[model samples]
Target: MTTGSVNPRRADTRRNHERILIAAAESLAGSGEVSFNAIAKHAGVGVGTVYRHFPTPEALILAVYRREVRHLVEVVPALLAEHPPEQAFRVWTTDHLAHYMMTKRGLATALRSASATGGDLPANAYEAMVGAVATLLKANVEAGTVRAELEPETVLRGLGGLLYLDSADEWRKQAAALADLLWRGMCTHRD
Candidate 1:
């Protein structure tokens, strides 16, 4: 599909591009490895098409990661619409943690490279995540369901810590427990 100034490609090309992305995500998630040949095979497209579209492995990985991030970001608004703010916030936090854990292996190299270069992740991605958290948090606070002093960034950092811990299952459970604690701490209780 055309995006802004970019003209839409032929239907076949668009399909090929989408196939490549899907294959890339699967490959990356399953093996944490991405090969042009494999992606092309998975996409049922020729290697030439893969190269034409991505040119480099990093580019392909970036595309897959961005696509996943966009999906997660989009879910925020939908969650907010479908549930109470407190519940929505809790569910999104858990989902975000799961997403990060599932993709951590596949994204390690790219994340490291970005860190080494002192570069930020994609701008839209960063903003989208922050906006989602802020929106949820603000709604809860306004409703007297959460603390006014709660900082979205700090909460995110805590979630990250849980994901980064070495004991995966244990840490994930703790993260859930910690989330419960956070909710309790943030909520207003009137005697």
Candidate 2:
């Protein structure tokens, strides 16, 4: 029972937990709803497993929301390392940020509907998002791709349009256009 030792059962439990969260997030994004049965089936786990991991729809939704926000914050460093600063900023905005914004709207509605559990999602998402944007902005500034004075808060405000994107519509195109518009403003000089 040592904490440092890798227990196979614990590892399997972690895997199942991640799988359930991914499945639940996808379900909420695609359908704006949560079905434990469907999530269990999609995650390839028994329904009882899902129930054990998340006793209520509200708990599952909150966990999914937290996982997504964590991903958004965590992915920035990898994106910066993988691409040039400008490309990293663009890709993070158009890919991770956009998808998360769209999914977030769905999660909100689902949370409201799942009133029985009464679990409140955390309020620090704004600060987390601002931190992510700040990291991206700093990289771009260091690379001389954007103005050094550009504020992360302002840039994030500009991206607020993403939250309104209707997944049923041309959201990807709209997201790209919005990001492009913001990028132009953020750039120190046109390429």
Candidate 3:
């Protein structure tokens, strides 16, 4: 679509918008900051287009966070295909943790602002992440690989807590340890 087009087709416009969001997320996640000009360059769109799509940095960052969650949701089926249920669960958890770290770096300030204003972050992102985890956990449980007592949401929250620990180095180590603990807790012993 040309820059001056009055109204692009919905699908095409959506594609462009998605591209811009993806580019913005990648740039922000990598650099821990985003510039509109840099995002436009990464998106292969004009700075005006970026402005048209996201009026403020907070809006762009929020969109990027949601996009990251959407991308993570899409990976669930692929991860299931590539790994066993248990392994897939671990892999996806790692991905979720990485996304959390990226989100914390790129959008934490904006998120805090939204909280202060009593604005909710997109709910679908949490639903998608939790749903993916639940699916994987259910699969493992059905396969007799994990304990039925394990709740997917609980495990996810635990992972978040582990990652948010006070010490960065300790947080990483503790996250891994916490994951292992969850795995062991969920595994059924073969007597």
* Strongest candidate by TM-score: 2
Identify the superior model by TM-score, candidate 1 or candidate 3.
Answer: 3
Candidate 3 lDDT over residue span 7-111, tens digit each: 657766787798888788777655657789998988888899899988877777777777677767788888888999888877766655655665566567666
Order by TM-score, highest first: 2, 3, 1
Candidate 1 local lDDT, 1-191, one digit each (tens)? 65656345677788899999889877765577888998899999999999999987777777777777777677887888998998887777665645555676666776566455654457677677667678888889887887788888776665565445333356556656767876776787733
Candidate 1: give the clashing pairs: none
Q: Which of candidates 2 and 3 is the stronger one according to lDDT? A: 2
Q: With candidate 3 superimposed using the best TM-score fit, by how many Å does residue 148's alpha carbon deviate from the native?
A: 0.5
- In order of listing, the candidates' clash counts read 0, 0, 0
Quantify all predictions' global Cα lDDT against the true fold: 0.73, 0.90, 0.73
Candidate 2 per-residue lDDT over residues 1-191, each given as its tens digit: 56898789999999999999999988888888999999999999999999999998888998999999999999999999999998998889889988988788879887776654667666898899999999999998889889999889999999988998888899889998999999998899986
TM-score of each: 0.72, 0.90, 0.73
Q: Rank the candidates by lDDT, best first.
A: 2, 1, 3
Q: Which ten residues in a row have the lowest lDDT in candidate 2?
A: 113-122
- Candidate 3 residue 135 Cα shift, in angstroms, is 1.0
Error of 1 at 22 (Å): 3.2
